[model samples]
Target chain A: MNRSTGFAFIAPLLVLMVVAFNLPIIYMLGLAFWDKGRGFTLEHYEGLLEAPVYLRVLGNTLRISLIATIANVAIGYPLAHWMRGLGRRARLIAIALVVLPFWVSILVRTYAWIVVLGNGGLVNRSLQWLGLTDAPVQFLYNELGVTIGMANVLLPFLVLPLFAAMIRIDDRLLQAAASLGAPPRTIFWKVYFPLTLPALAAGTLLVFILCLGFYVTPAVLGGGRVPMISNLLDTLINQIPRWEQASAISTILLIVALVIFAGYRRLDRKASA
Target chain B: MTSTPWSRRLLAAAGIFGLVFLTVPLLIVIPMSFSPARALTFPPPGFSLRWYQALFGDPRWMEAMSTSTIVAVLSSVAALVLGSLAAYGLRRGSFAGRDWAEGNFMSPLIVPTIIVAIALYLSLAKVGLLGSFVGLVAAHTVLNVPLVMMVMGVAVRDFDLRIEQVAWSLGASWSYTVIKVMLPNLAPSVFAAWIFAFIGSFDEVIVTSFIAGKYETVPKKMFNELILEVNPTITAVATLLIAVTVLALAAVTLVLGRAGKLGQTLVER
Candidate 1:
């Protein structure tokens, strides 16, 4: 095929993307930086700085994202490690379990937390049944609830990559380490851990990026009490009609996400390489 | 190196806990969907289809269901056709800026969806297309393009260009070669890509919620209802969503597994 045929094949999609995706983003940047009469201004960004609400939402988003990402690492690393050690059939089942929720709607998964963590829900019920507490614990409509939901929903993001990396480690290397008289703990810490570090870092970055932009979980689980950046953006665009400020905040988020994604790409290449 | 027995057991316990943690909520919701009572309780006093009845009986929900289906079908088909053609071109053509074009196509997936939502909301409102069905379909098509591209890109890259060259050498037109040769070999991938795009569009909430003014897709409605109250009717919706996802994923896995592309498609991302 000639080169132009290739370009022809891509032309339609390019047109659609430019019109639907690219132009809109550019327009948003224009809205953020270009005022109607002022031509170019940082007024929207300055407005963001002037409001304590924006700063509070930013801090809340960062803190919640951090906690969620940490929870993902805590649960996901061990899960992936365990899957790496499983037998073949068990491994497939484990993979299916992990992959299933990844494909499920984020709304469904976030909603499920309500059923599981509500005051009259299973966890509290079980806690009460076990006599661990006299009263039901409040797991809904709080930061803790939002964090747990986020962690659960994003766990597969961390585990799948980490597990793939763990499976790629040669068993012979471990055997070789064992033959050299290294203890199991030492072998895992010194050899295996370092080997999976690149993938772990890449996956963690990926999950963190996802958590930063998380909208549905925090909205459903946080119940408006805990405000994340996405929720604040929602209020700006949908409720308050603050389009310029929303665009400005979105620009900052887009730049931050892109920068972190670049980092993820570098680590991902190293992990796969 | 083998761990000590106690440590191995500890790892096993932690791993099981993690799996349970991930899956228990979904497992709980499925049974709760069948509860006889109106409350969100576990292990219902009796098994009843009341929630499902409530879901199917409501006209508003029925309207949402129809809307969701139409949007998902139209957008998924569009994404499949456009994305596949682009993938074939990117793989076969030595075009300038091919890499940049491919990256731009995939950017929708990488960018925070909320940003996309806001951008589309602002731009669409400016153009007086906010809450319009055309805008909704176009938005979903854009969001789902990456899913189709990811699957088709791999399929096209793996398909041997020599086969197409042979077809061309045999006096076949380019369209004929694609329709007869390439389509046959890439059928499984096309099915998988369509399913993925369908699910992606169907389950989408953020973008749909943003620009879909006066429109209620199932997820958008479900989200609104959940925020206001925990209705048992939503349990039924959640179960249906789960069922659709499971079946769709099973179809993808079976087809892609037969094609021996499942492992690469799942893990290479």
Candidate 2:
């Protein structure tokens, strides 16, 4: 079989990707540099630095991502361990439970949180009924709600990789340690924990990068009062129609995410080495 | 050995708590959709089908659904063709720049979708493709083609080349060999790819906002409703979405569990 024939078959795909997929990204980077009105001004990039708002939002986005990553790790590690211990059928069911949310629309998942956390929602009614509070606690329209929502949406992401790593771990090692008189905690910390660090790193990298670019979750759950970088990008585009600024922020976002992801890749390589 | 009993119990409780945390909010939306008060309240004041009626009655929602379906169907088909073709081209042995192509092709999966959306918006606007139905299809194809490629890449790798060889030896034409021998083996994965691509396009809100000029996808409409207005009918729509999601995941699970186990077998090379 001629590999050239294979190239002929794939040429359309490569062309389509180069044109529609790759070109647009390169185009966006171009737009960031040369504005239509200003003829290649750094004003937009400068604005990002000069404006405290962008910096604050960037810092805050990083903070929230860290918090959510921590939450996911805390919840995901045990869930993965538990699923690893399950029988085959039970493990499949558990896998499905984790994947169902992944397959669902982000919009639908955010709506679900709204229903539960709304002022006239289950939590408020429960609090009121139990005489805990006379009023709704304002769960929605805040950072806490956004964190909870992000964690719920991202939990499966953390768990899946962790589960994969856990399942591949040899049980005999644990038994060996046990027979050698190592306690359960000691075995877990020394043997199991070190092995799963790679998965944890991968999951955190994914979830954190995703969190930084997240628009819908924070916007819907944050009630427009809280602004992440994406939320701020929306304002500049829709309300102010500042394409230059929008492009600038988006470019920064793209680069920051890529840089961090690249950094993680290097760290992962070094750690594995 | 599992663990100490105390640790085992603790992990089990955490596992249960995690599952509930992930699933309960999604389930709670079902009853809220039926709330007669047009607001989300616990133990809903009463149950009624008014929200569903409103959703079925609304032309705007219907239009959005129709648009999304048309866009999804068109893009998924396009993605399947383009992606599968690409997969068929690459053999197991590495080619020069295969690593670069592989990484770049899947870059769409990384690099924030918002960036993609914005970039596509700008480029399409330049060529006057903004908000055009064709633009939406093209943008969506870009989003889903990589997924299709990833899925079909596995199927192609696992495929028995000997079967394809027999067809060739029997003097089957190129198209006939592909249509008869190769495609049959690829059918399960093709279907799975189509569903994933369809769901991705259908549920896409961010990218649609950029190029879907004058068009409203169901998710984009739902976003507007979520942000600007509160409607009980949106709840009804969401419940229907949950039902669809259940069906979609079921199909995915079945396909993945079956023979070949395409996605389960291979990953990015």
Candidate 3:
């Protein structure tokens, strides 16, 4: 097809996307400068920086995301290594199992954790049953709860790429490494580990970026106390209707996540090359 | 050789632990729904079907379910149409900016879903389309198209174009050739894409939370009920969800079995 005709054919969807998807993001950016709707101003941004609550929430989001990312990568690496050696049938079953929770709603999954970790929950109940504790321990509505909830939600994401990368590695190369007088530790450290780094890095970036934007997990599990940027935004919108401040915080979040993701993409391309 | 046994054992233990970790929440929650005890606890004093009965007897759950089902079905069908056309166009027609076009369509999959939800809610609310079924369907279709494209792209990647060319040479029209020669091969991919799109819309909470404004889908209903009051009915809904997931995955496994054998056969050449 000619250029004009091609553009014509695709124009409808393109216009729909621009109007339906892109405009609101642009509007959000526009709203960050609102000064009581009379004139454009940067008061929201100034408030965001100056407000201790906003700063704490931003720090909390970053800290939680960083911790969850590390936890996911730490768990995902070994799991992926083990998955690589499994037979085809077993591997498929493992993958399906791992991805099962992802198919379920995050709201349900976070609630499930509440039942598992709450006062008189499975863990505390078990501990009491075993005579390990005199009282039921409080585990829910805290940083620990947030981390568990976010990690469980994001674990599949980290595993999928790592599993895919591991599956792509030629098994014979491992045998070759073994034959070349490399110890198992050396072979793992020098050969297998380096090969999987790209996937590990990709999965880490994916999990971290996703965790940064987590809302429901923190909201439900944190009991509206331990605040992240999402919970803060939720409050700003719902409880107070501070649209300007909400818009400002959201724009900051969007920019930070996009910049990190873009950086990861560049690193991924370079690593792959 | 010495390390082999230890490593294997550790791996087996890890695998089992991971499996149990992934599944036990759903498994425990499902059985816990049937507990005669008022509070949600690990072990039940006795068993009753009160929660399931409540779920079935409630009109709200039924309404939410029907709404979700309708939205899911319509959106998946819409995605299949638009995504299939776009996939076919890109696969068959080479152009100067093919990569750019592909990137544009696939960008939705990469962007954070909250951003998409916010963007969509703002635009729809402005046009008074918010909470309308058409708006939901259209939004979900756009979100689902990238998944369809990915799966269909895989299906069409290694297909021999010359088969269609040969049929056309024998006087078959383009549509006939496609329906006869190409579609049968693409059926599994299309079905898989449909499944993904359906599940994407069904499990979707972030977007639905923002846009469902006044109207409640099943997930939204569950979200509200859970926050307001923790009920056995929520557990019942979760159990139902797990059942649906298992059935869906069973069907997927069967499809994968066929696809796997077909792939191995093709790879032998």
Candidate 4:
């Protein structure tokens, strides 16, 4: 194909991106710095630091995201490792089991948790049936519920990458460690764990970044009581329609995601090299 | 490596627990959908398809489903066209700033959907496109194009363009070469792209929530329903969505597995 023709073919996507993707983010970034009444200022960015509520929400966002990421890793790592140990057919089945939830809508999955963990819901009833507790536990509409829900929602994200990472890990390395007098636990901690760090890093970064932006799970599970950055950004834009504050939060989130993404890319390059 | 007895036990128990943790809630939704009871209860009292009937009967539910289907179809088709073009262009020959150009296209999947939500809202509303079908399709197309490119780009990478050149050398037009040679060769990835874009658009909620305005897709309708009250019909909707997902997954696996790229194909959506 000729140069112009090739460029012409690519032009539609470029034009659409300019209109839909690139311009909107630029506009949002402009809104962050552009004040309607004052024309232009760093007031919104300054306000993020000045206001305790914004700062608190920012802190809450980081804290909750960290917890969610940690939780996902705790759950996903062992599962990925186990799948790695299984036969090929069994591994595929295990993977299918893991990937199944990614098909479910985030809202639906979060809603399902409300059913599973709600007062007088399945977990509560099961507990009652077992005579473990006298009263129904308040699992939903709380941080624990939100954490569980978010972690669960992000599990596939974690496992898929971890599984892929582990798939690349040569068994010979483990054998090398074992033959060199490393015990099973030592082999895992030394050879297995170190080799999987790239995938571990990749999954952690993905899950953490995702958790940082996650809205539905935290919104539904938090029951409006807990606040994450995404929800806070939503409240600023939707309920209060505070465009400046919302833009600031969105910008902060964009920066955080980019930084971590860049960091992960660096790690990935090193791992691959 | 032979694991210690305690280690084996630990792995077995944790594996079982993880699988159950992953699947039990989904399984719970099935029975809840069939329950004759109104409330969200487990071990649902008696089985009935009342929710299914209700879902089918309700115009709002049906409208949402149809609207979602329309958006999903229209957006995916557009995304496939545009994304394939971009993928082909990128793969044709290396260019300066090619990485930068690719980054712009893939940014949607990485950037938070909420950011995309607000961005599309502001940009679309500015041009008098918000809440309209045009606006939603535009936004969804943006969201799904990267998915198409990722899937189709794999095919583009694998299939040598020399055949297309040869076809052109034989007097076949560029369009003709692409249509007759390239497409058939990359059919599996085309199917994969369509499936990803279709399902991605269908399952999209956050961006749609912001830009959808009056056009309520299924997820938006369900979100609204939750805001009012959790209804039995939602379980019905979820069940249907799950069923759709299963079929879609099966189809994708069948196609992409044949291509030996199922692992890469599975993660995008």
Best-to-worst TM-score order:
1, 4, 2, 3
| Poorly placed runs, candidate 1 (over 4 Å) | none
lDDT of 4 by residue, B143-216 (tens): 99988999877778778778888998999987888899988878888998998899999999989888888999
Off by over 4 Å in 2: A35-41, A130-134, A263-273, B92-95, B260-269
Best by TM-score: 1
All candidates in order of DockQ, best leading: 1, 2, 4, 3
Identify the superior model by DockQ, candidate 2 or candidate 4: 2
Q: List fnat, each candidate.
A: 0.83, 0.67, 0.26, 0.55
Q: What are the per-residue Cα lDDT tens digits for candidate 2 across B1-269?
A: 44668778888999989988888888888888888886567778888999998998999999999999999999999989988887777754345676677667677878888888888887887788887888789888988987888788888987888888888899999899888888877778888888889998989988887668799989999998889867778889888888898998777767766864733732222
Candidate 3 lDDT, A57-111, residue by residue in tens: 8889889989988877766777777777888889767777887776777777877
TM-scores, chain A, per candidate: 0.98, 0.91, 0.93, 0.94
lDDT for each candidate structure: 0.94, 0.82, 0.76, 0.84
What is the fraction of true interface contacts found in candidate 3? Answer: 0.26
The TM-score, computed over Cα atoms with residue i paired to residue i, of candidate 2 is 0.95
Clashing pairs in 2: B131-B213
Off by over 4 Å in 3: A1-12, A33-41, A267-273, B1-4, B261-269
Considering the two chains of model 2, state its CAPRI-style docking category: medium
DockQ of each: 0.84, 0.67, 0.40, 0.65
Q: After superposition, how far is residue A83 of candidate 4 from its true place, in Å?
A: 0.2
Tell me the tens digit of each residue's lDDT in model 4 across A26-72: 99899888977888888988878888988787777788889989988
